[model samples]
Target: MGSLRTCSRSACERAAVATLTFVYSDSTAVLGPLATYAEPHCYDLCTSHAERLTVPRGWEVVRLALPTTPQEPHPDDLVALVNAVREAATDRNQDTGPGVRGSKGTLEPPAGAGAGGARRGHLRILREQ
Candidate 1:
């Protein structure tokens, strides 16, 4: 089951109903419906915050109309999600194959993997534009 996304505003614990993305090149801010997945560079906002959103001086704000009612996930979306999870699990198992375990029964990064080497982690750092 999926968990509710919270607003990105400080001390605001309201459920997010919109996603805010900034287009630096156009000096524009886009406020749209909640994204399927959370993005590092985007902000998730509640209805109130989204409605009251303000952009920097000279910046344009583009508001995308949100749906009046929540909708169920499509079958295709559910299938895709399941496939992605299975692929990730397969990849993880392959990386931590036999003899790659630490003495403490923990998985160790494969040869030449990690910081200053091949990336092997559940989380990835997004590069700034």
Candidate 2:
């Protein structure tokens, strides 16, 4: 989905919460939910602009139900968060083997930590004795 769009009305910089479109044949102005993609003929409006919208003398105004609350996080986003936490936990657990101190006083990964449990990047997880 696209980021929050600003109201199309000039000089009004509020985030758009609704979309407005006109039906020339029916002489009606429709105000509803934000469009998936902005169209040349559709106008994106903020809460104030959408509520105060007016049309020509003979034009009818049709207002569709607007969302009362903010949008929730996408399911994919939640799943990604969970996966990242799991990966971090797994990495920490794999580094639990006692670290060996080299001649240079640098801690080295346990012998079996090679190949499969190879340390990633320059950072290593340290556990208290």
Candidate 3:
């Protein structure tokens, strides 16, 4: 949601249309569509630079084509978001009491939920690659 970044080329002020990344160890140059977030070591390139990009002596240039249809929020997404907000604003917010997270990331079932009937309470965090 921050401001859009422009090309890194000197004296050429244009909205960055692609991202340029170089892998020094692999001798590869990846020039693709702009990333969701700006990276510190990556270079932002405009359309001209993206099309006329070049690689180093033995480096391979991998150009990625951007998707044609932008994935903006559709009507269904808006309706779902609105419904979620309305649900959170209603009485459902009072069900979640404090001490939801146990001593060390343990799943302590909510009040008045049997051992194994159904998952009445929700929200579990799992770390997987």
Clash totals for all models, in order?
Answer: 0, 0, 0
lDDT of 1: 0.77
lDDT of 2 by residue, 1-129 (tens): 434688999999988889999999999999998887899999999889999998999999999998875455599987998679667756655566335332222244556663444454665534333
lDDT of each: 0.77, 0.76, 0.69
- C-alpha displacement of 117 in model 2, angstroms? 17
Best-to-worst TM-score order: 1, 2, 3
Candidate 2 TM-score versus the reference:
0.56
> What are the per-residue Cα lDDT tens digits for candidate 3 across 18-124?
88999899999998878878999999888788888888688898888954433343689778985785566443434544444421222334556554533624743
Candidate 2 Cα misplacement greater than 4 A, ranges: 1-3, 77-129
Q: Top model by lDDT, which number?
A: 1
Model 3 superposed RMSD (Cα): 12.5
Sort the predicted structures by lDDT, highest score first: 1, 2, 3
> Of the pair 2 and 3, which is ahead by TM-score?
2
> Model 3: how far is 10 from its true place, Å?
1.3
